[model samples]
Target: MIDFWLAAGLLLLVALSFLLIPVLRGRRAQLEEDRTALNVALYQERVAELQTQQQEGVLDAVQMDAGRAEAARELLADTEGVAAPRVSRLGKPLPLLAAILVPVLGLGLYLHFGASDKVELTREFAQAPQSMEEMTRRLERAVAAQPDSAEGLYFLGRTYMAQDRPADAAKIFERTVNLAGRQPELLGQWAQAQYFADGKKWSDKIQSLTDEALKADPKEVTSLGLLGIAAFEAERYQDAIDYWNRLLVQLPPDDNSRSALQGGITRATEKLQASGGKVAQAPAAKVAALLKVHVDLAAELKDKVKPGDSVFIFARATSGPPAPLAAKRLTVADLPVTVELGDADAMMPQLKLSNFPEVQLVARISRAGQPTAGEWVGRSQPLASSTTVPQRLIIDSPDK
Candidate 1:
């Protein structure tokens, strides 16, 4: 922020210099005009003396004529260096007043409309915070600087939850959902925060939030975990075990959270048996379709494209929503590499290649990181969702 202010001050000084230079030049011009007038007055006085001497017969006509010629020469020599005064329709006072107001008006306008707070926020975020409390403070300032930013609000809400400030987290998450739409993940986050803020008491609002999130994505991990926790607290051990078992199915094999969730299920099972309740075990997980694909850039565009550009490869349903079922991101430099798209890579739990009867493969190259709009694209005809053959796609055409 100090550096930014210094640079801004330097620019203001440069602008002031442009305004003051003309006024300073006008002063120098006035000095030249005064010097010319002084010289002319001296020449007039000398001529008056010459005329008096002639009138009194102290000098002859030829001597008077020589005196007049010498006086005229001396006057010409004295005034020759003076330049013509420039005409200024805007006189001295106006320029001086403008010079004063320029900086004042600039500072006023900048204070009213400039992004100084955002500038400071950007500089603050450039470095890592030494503590979580510091991080939360920075995020709070960032959200204040950009009140309409959903991403910043969401992160701030998460920070509040991390700090055990559930009441604040609930408010922030509700605002986030309002701005970003009630997506499953955001809804789940809001529900969890609200539940905790209400002293772990379940209410219609929290229930509605969780139900809505699950309705959109049944395997929303946060909602599942929160429901399991709520069920356990209510002494409904079987329900807790069931909710956790469902969550366990959605986690990746190598996920660190899987072990903890499994431990919770084990504890729930013991509690259920001790309470004389029957425990129904959850069914084994089903593996979704895994499609292998090879992506390549067109030979003609090899030199025209940047190597750092983003490339998105995905499979979308042929007869459903526009969102990709499973997607992967890579760079142009990673082209010709093979990638696997499966339920494991699902962008959402409810959307997977196996859930769609027919799917199309798409690969897009975008410099701006937008998946839908890009410079180049490649697509495959509708294929069976369970297709076992490896597919090859070349980005050989414009996106339009």
Candidate 2:
């Protein structure tokens, strides 16, 4: 901001120069005009002296004429190079007044419209914060500066949560949801924050938020973890185990949280067993089937599609529900690209590639960006889910 202000001041100086330079030049021109007039008066005085000498019979007519001509020559020499006096319609005061007002008006307009606060925020974020409190302060200022910025609000909410200010986090998350729409991840964050903000007591509002989030995305990790924690707190050991188990499946093997989640599941199982309840055995781990596919637009449909159109690729069970078992999304600009789909890409918790024995591949191009419905589509013949061969799918037929 210091540098920014310095640059702005320099520009203002440059602008002031444009206005002031002309007025200064006009003053210099006025001095030249005055000097020219002085020279004319001196010439006239010399001529009057010469005429007096001629009238006193000290000089003849020819001498008098020569003397007068010499006086005129001297006047011309003194006034040589003096330009014609220029008349300014604006006068002297107007330009000077303008020079004074230019900077003031410019600064006023800039303050009214410029993004100085945002610029300062950017500069502050460029360096690593010295402490968590300092970082939190900066995030708070950023959110204040851009109240409508969903990303800023989201980060502020997360920072508040980390600082154990759950009440503040809940409010910020609610603002984030309002600005960014009720996205699954945001809803999960909001629910978790609200749950903690309410003194760890469950409420219908938190339940609704979590349900909506999980319904939109069953693998929403935050909501799953929150539900598990709530169940464990309420002494519902079996329910806690179920939620934790679901969450465990979504975590990657290398994730640092996996061990902690496994520890939680073990604790819940032990609690359930202590209560004389029969614990369900964990399912056998199965290797997820990964299918590599190359998708492209059919040459015949090249003219029928736009570059910005959406492309959805998926595998569905050949004889079961129409819902995709695994799916990926792309754009028409990324056509002729290779993608891999597996259990990790399942749209729902119960639907997975490993659950199906045989499936068919599909590629759809939608101008409206709808995955289920599109303008054109293509499909592959039913094949075993475990097939390792890379299949090619081209979208050519009109969608029914």
TM-score of each: 0.76, 0.76
Q: Which lDDT tens digits does candidate 1 get at residues 100-159?
A: 898899889998999998988888799999999999989999998899999999999999
lDDT of 2 by residue, 307-392 (tens): 89999999998855568999998888898899999989999866788767889999998999999899999999999999999999
Candidate 2 clashes between residue pairs 3 or more apart in a chain or in different chains:
none
**lDDT of all predictions:** 0.91, 0.91
RMSD of candidate 1 to true structure, Å: 5.9
Cα lDDT, model 1, residue 202? 98
Candidate 2 lDDT for residue 52: 94
